[model samples]
Target: MKGKWHSSWLLLLIAVVLVLSACSSGNNSSSSADNKEEATSSGEPQDGGELKVGLSANPKTLDPILYTGVYESQIMRQVADTLVVYNKELSDFIPSLAKEWKVSEDMKVYTFTLRDDVYFQPGEYQDGRQMTAEDVKYSLERSAKESAMNRLRGVEKVEVTGEFEVEVHIGTPNAALLAMLTDSGNIIVPKEEVEGWGDQFGSHLVGTGPFQIKDWQKDSEVKLTRHDKYWGEKPHLDGVSFKIISDPNMMTNALRSGDLDVGTDIKGQNRELIKTDQNLELLSKPALSLTYLDLNNKKGPTADPKVREAIYKATNVEEIVKGVNQWGGAEPSFMGLPKQSWGYSKDLEKLKPTFDPEAAKKLLAEAGYPDGFKTELYLSEARVPYGTIFQNQMKENLNVDVELKVVEWGTYSDTVAKGNAPMSIGGWTWYPDPYFFLYQLFHTDQIGALGNGKGYSNPEVDSLLERAVSETVDQNERAKLYQQALEIILKDVPRIELDNLEASAGINKKVQGYDVSSDFSIIIVSPNGTNVWMKQ
Candidate 1:
C-alpha cells in the first residue's frame, strides 16, 4: 500500500510540470507573433527623433576656409557641400555638388557641370537662391588666401563658362587636383552671404547641405535643423544637437547614461567599458592620420641630425602603442604617410629606426649632448598621455629630460604655428594622395603656418614632390617618385613617426545607420543622417 501511494505522488508532480511547460511555450509563440505583426505593419524605417552628439571640443571657427582642425570640419560638413567626396573605402571619389566633370587631354583644365537642383539654405542673407557656377568660382577664389590654398598651387584661373558650368585652368597638370577639390575648404558658399557677413562670416555659416545651423554658442553647444529642400533624400531626424564635452570620462558617462546618442574621441579604458554595455555600440575605423613628435630643425639641440636620429632610435614605439592600446589598433611606423595610402612603400621598412640604446648614446655624444639636455615638449591636453610616454622613454633610454607643457587645443595650435615649442607632439590628416602627404608637410614653401610646422626643408624632397604632382600622371610613376622623396625625408628625421590612429565613437543602440570612415571625416558618417533612424 505504501509503495503505491509514493508512485501516485510522483505521477502527480510530473503531470503538473508538463502542464507548466506547455503554458510557457504557448506564451512565447504569442509574443513572437505579435512582434512580427508590429514590424510588418510599421515598415523598416521609423523617423522623427533628435540625435544628440557629444563632441570632444568646440569648433574654433565654422568658416570652412579658416578652420583647420577636425572639430571644426565636423560642424562645417553639416552646413557645406563639397565638389567630390570619398567612397566608403576612401580609395575612390564620388560626385557631390558637381554632377559630372571633364578633363582636358593634357589634364591641365577641368570643366565641372554644377547641378541646378541644389539650393542654398534659406537664411537672413540668402533667399533660397540656387547655387550656380559663379558661386563656385567665387568660393574658390575667396579661399585662395587661406592655408588651404596650398592644394590649389598650380591653378592659374577659375572661369565661369556657362550658367551651370565652370572651368578651372592649371598652369601644370596636377595629379591631386580632383582630390584637392574634395576638401571641405572648397565648399561652395553663396556670394551674397559672404559679402554681407564679411569678418563675422565664420560665426554665421551659410551653404547648401542637408542641415543648417540654427543656433551656435561658443564653448557650449550647436543646434542644427534639417533642410527640407535638400537636393538629396530628406534627413530622417528632425534635428541634431552637438554638445561640447572635453573630458573623456564625462563624455563616456553621458553616452552610457543615454544623454548622448553618439560621442567622438572616446579613448583608453572607456572604449572597453562601452563595448561591454548591452545598450551601446562602438564604431571604429583605421584612420589615415598620424601622430608624431615634431622636432624643431631650425634651432636648439634637435636641429642636429644626429640628435634627431638618437631620439628616434632610443624611443620604443611598441611601448607607446601599448600605452594607447584602447585608442586604436595602432602599430609603429617610420614614414609620414599611412600604411594603406596609395603611394606608401613597403621597401621603406628596411630603413626604419630600431631600438638601440648604445647607438643612441653614441649619437647623442656626437651631437655635443653627452650629458643630455632639457627641452619643453608642447602637447594638447587631450593627447598628454602620448607625450608623457615619449618623454619617459627619452629620459630612460637617451638620458634626455623632456618637460611637458600641456595646453588647450587652441593655444597649442597657435604655439606650434609660431614655431615656439622646441619639441612638440603634433599630427596631420593629409588628403588621400601622396602629393598632400609630401608637398603640404615637407615642402619648403609650406614652412610657415601651413602643415610644415617643423621648419624642416630639403630641396631634393621638394623637387621630387613637384615632379610627382606636375609631371607624373601615372599612378605607378607617381608612387615611385614619392618613395624616393620619402627615403630622403626619413634620412633627415625631422619628425618621429609614432602610429596611425583609429577614430572611434560610442553610440547608443537606439541609433542606426551610423558608421565611421577610414579617412576620419565626420561628414562621411552617413552624411546628413538621411538613412539614419531611431527606435522608440
Candidate 2:
C-alpha cells in the first residue's frame, strides 16, 4: 500500500488557464455561465485549492471508460470531459467538449459540433495534440469494444461531419443516449493514448479536464495535479489526493482524528455512533443507492422460481428500514427500481417481494426445501457501509443458515454484474436513467459477461426497455414503458429487491462548500476549510 503523499496545489501543480470562447463565439457557455457552475445544491464555483478525499476502497482503474462504479467514476469525472456533461447539479445536460448539437427530425441521428479549443494534455503523445473530430469518432468507436462499455457497441455509425462537428447515427433513436452521455462514462479520452495503454489505461488515464494525473499507487493512493490546457473552469484546490483504506472503522477514526479531510462510506452499520461524534460532521440524504440479493437462474440451486420466491417472502424490507437504518435512512421496497427512478410504481412496492412467511414456506416446500436450504450469501464491500445487516436479516427471516462471502470491490462488481457468482449481493447507484440500472442487470442478449448472475430473460421486458428508448415521445409514455418493464422484472425475481438506502456522508462540520443533493454528490472546500463558499 502506498502511504499518503501530499502536494500543495499552489506550489506543486501547474495552474490551467481554460480560456472560453466568448458566449457568442460558438464554444461552451461563457465565463459568466462558468461562474454559475456548482457541483450540486449549496455548492459554489470552482476555486483553487487542495482536497483530501479518502476513499474506502482502492480504484480498479482511473480510466473512465473502464471503471464501472462510484468514487472511481466520480474521480474520473473530475479529470475528464465528455461530449455532454450533466449540469453541475445533474438536473440537466449541458454541452462540454461538443460545443453544440442538433437533433435530427427523426431524432435517430444527432449531429454535434466539436470545439477547436479542446486539446489533449501533453503526454507521451506529442505536445499540442489538438482534439479533432476524428478523435471523437475513434473514442466512441473504441468504446464499442470496451469490456465495460460493450452495451454501447450497439451504435450503428459515427461519422465526422466537418472540422468542428460529428454525427452519431444510432441503431435506433435511443432516448437514453443523452442520459448515457451525462454519465461519468462517455468521457472522451485522447485517441492517441488509448490503443497502446492496454490494462494500464485504467490507471494511466489522461483527459482534457482541469486535472491531470501525477501518480497512482495500486491499492493505495492516486494523486492528480491540475491540467492547464483544460477548457473549463479550474478547480480551486491545487491537487486532490485520494487514499484507499478498506476498514470502515478505520476510515471513521481517521476522519474523527483529523488525519483525513473527507471520507466515503463512513458508517460501520452503526448510525448512533456516527450521529454522536462531535469532531466529525455526517452529511447524508436520500442517495441513488438501491441494494438487492440476486438468485442465479442459469445453473444453480436458486434456478427454481419457487426457491426465488422462498427467499423473497422470507425477506422483510420494512423490518430492515427500522432495525438496521433508523435515520429515516431507508424505505422498505420491493420496488425493483430505485424509489426516485422514472416509472417507479408505488403499487409495485406492494407487488415486489414482501414479508410473507406463509408464501415463502409454501414455495420452499414445493421446491423440496421444506426445511429451508443453507447457502452462502456473497456480499460486496463496495456496496453499502455494511453487508452483515442484510446477511443477518436473511438468516433471521428465512431461518436459513447462510455463510457469508464478503468480497472486495473490483472482483465483486464483476462477480455480481457479470454472473460469476450465484446468489450474490449488490447495489446500483442510479441517477441519469433507469437504463443505468436496467441495462446492466437485464438485457440478456447483450454484453456477455455482464448481468446480475441471473440469466433473466423476458421478451416483453426487453422489448419495453428497448422501445422506451427507440421510440421518441412525451415523458409520460416512456415512463409507462418502464413500469411495464419493472412488472416483468418483479415477476422473474432475478434479484430480491432490497431497500433503497438513504445515502449519508460523514462530513466535518468545519469543511465548507458541501453540496447536498440526491442526484449529484461532488463537493468543494475553501483553503482553510472554514467557509463553504459558492456561486449563488
Candidate 3:
C-alpha cells in the first residue's frame, strides 16, 4: 500500500510541471503579438511622398554664385551642397561634400579632402558625374571671381593638389572663412554644366545634392525630384515643390486647406492661427537678423552725434518692438548683433540708452534744435509700422514734426544703399558671426552697397574689427574684441537698434522632423533637415 501511494505522488508532480509549461508558452505568444500591434500604431518616418512647400516670394534665381537674396538660397540650397554645413547657431560645422578639412597654423590655407561618393545630379547640360577636387577648385575660384555678393573675396585661390584633395589659400587670416563657406555661394558646382550653360546657368542648375531641379515656372512654382544616388542618407520624400504664394494670407489658407505641407514666413495672426489649429504647428526660431533705423553719419541732421544720441534717448525701443511685432515675432535688441548670436554680450544690455524725453530735449537744444526739426523717415511698405511708431514717438517726446516716406522696396533699398535717406529703416540677415554683422555694417571701408550705408567711419572701431578677424583662432578672444567694438558703436549711435526678427513657419502635423534655421535658410532634404519625413 505504501509503495503504490509514493508512485501516485510522483505522477501528480509530473502532471503539474507539464501544465505550467503550457501556460507560460501561451503568455509569451500573447505579449509578442501585443508589441507588434503597438509598433504599427506609433508614428514612424514614411517614405515615397512629395512635399509641397509655400514660398512668400518667388526665387530670383537658382544660380548660387549670382543670387543675392535669401529667397534664392532657399531654392538653391535644395539643389546644391556646401563643403561644410554650420549649425543654426553658427557655433560648429559638419562636413558635407568635403569629407574632411584642415586649417594651417597661420589660418590662411584650408586643405580639403573630397568625398569619394558624391555625384552631381544629372541635368540638361551634362550627365551626372562624380564630384572631384577639380569641381571644388572650379566652383570656389568662380565664386571668388564672379559672385555678386563677394562672399569669397578673402579666398585668394583654390589649387587642386590631388585627384581628391584641394587647398584654398587666403591673403589674410580670416576667422569668418569657415562660417562664410557655409553660405550658399560656396556650393560646389559641376564644371561641365556651368561652362555649357554660360550666362543661362541660373536657369539650368546642377549640383551634388539630395534634390535635382525638375522645373521652375517663374512666379508659379519650383519643382524638385529626389536624386536616388545621393551619397548620404537618402531623402525620405520623393520630391519637393515650392509653390510661390506672394500673399501671406493665401499661404496660410493653403496650409489650412491641406494644399501645402509647409508655409514659409508665416507671421502676425497666422502664427496664432496655426498655434490654435489642432492639425498645424508653428515652428519659430530666433533669427540672426535685425531691423534697425539707420542714422546717416555723412550729411544730415542725424549726422550730428548729439542729434543721434538725442533720438536714441527719446525713442523707446522696447515699446517700438512690441508695437511692430504685435503678434510676437521679434525681441527688442540693444546691440548690432542679435541676442541669438554666440558672440552677443549680455553685459552690453546694461549700456542700452534709457528713455528720457527730458534729457533728449536738452541734447536737441545743445545741438541747436530745442524744437525738434522735421525729417523724413524713409521706409518700404513692410516697414511702415516701424516708421509710424517712430514718427509718433519723435512728435510726442521731442515736439518734432516727422514725415513718413513710404516707397517701393527697390527705391527704398537704393536710397538707403546710397546714404541718401536721412533716417531709413534697414534690415540685415546673416549668420551668427559678429564679423558679418559689425564689419560689414559698421566698418568705414564698407560705406556703400556693401553694407555701411550710414557712412559710419571710426578708425578705432575699424582697428578692433580687423584685429578680431586676424588675431586669433580662440573665439573667446575674438568675442572680446567684438565686445569692445560694440561699446564704442553703442556710444557713437550709428544706428538705433530696434529688434531682432524670428523665422517662423507653419507646418502640417503630417510633416515630421522639420527645422527652422536662424539664418532663414531652408534645407528640407539634407542632413540639416534632420531626417525629415512625411506620413501617408
lDDT of 2 at 285: 63
> What would the per-residue lDDT of candidate 2 be over residues 1-536, giving only the tens digit for each residue?
13333344433343332223233356446645654553433454445555667786677876656776677875786677778765544445667788788788777787888888887777665564788888888777666556375535456778988987898887767777776665556777886677667667777787777677888888888888877777765455677777887887777777777666676764445345567888666766656677777778766668887788778787765665566565556766665577666556777665666678787888878888777667766775554433466567556666677777877867676776566566776666766467667766787664344454667877888888888777764457887888888877888777777667766666665456664446534544211122232222
Query: Could you give candidate 1's per-residue lDDT for residues 1-536 as a string of tens digits?
Result: 99999999999999999999888787997877677568645656555788888989778787767777778878887788888776666665677888888888888988998888999998778798898999998887666545453545566778999999999888878878888887778888998888789878889898888888999988999988888877877777787889999999999999999989998886778888899999998887667788888998888998899999999989888888778775455677779888767888889977878889889999999989998999999988867878888999989888899999998878787877777878888777767688777787889988876367779899999899888977746778889999999999998898888888777888998787777756666652233333666765
TM-score of 2: 0.72
Error of 1 at 498 (Å): 1.6
Question: CA lDDT, every prediction?
Answer: 0.82, 0.67, 0.87
In angstroms, give how far residue 210 of model 2 lies from its true place: 1.9
Q: Model 3: residues >4 Å from true position, as ranges?
A: 1-43
**Residues forming the 10-long window of minimal summed lDDT in candidate 1:** 521-530
Of candidates 3 and 1, the better by lDDT? 3
Residue 149 accuracy (lDDT) in model 1: 36
Model 3 clashing residue pairs (backbone): none
lDDT of 3 by residue, 1-536 (tens): 99999999999999999899887776997876666555435865667788999988877777878897788888888888889997645677878888889988898999998789888898776678888999989999999998888988889899999999999999999988888888899999998888888888888888887888888898899999998888888898899999999899999999999999999998998989999999999999789999999989998788899999999999999899988787898998888998877789999988878899899999999999987798888888888899898999999999888798999988887888888888888888888788999999999888887378889999999999999999886788999999999999998888899998998899998898787888887878665446677876
RMSD of each: 8.3, 13.8, 4.3
lDDT of 1: 0.82
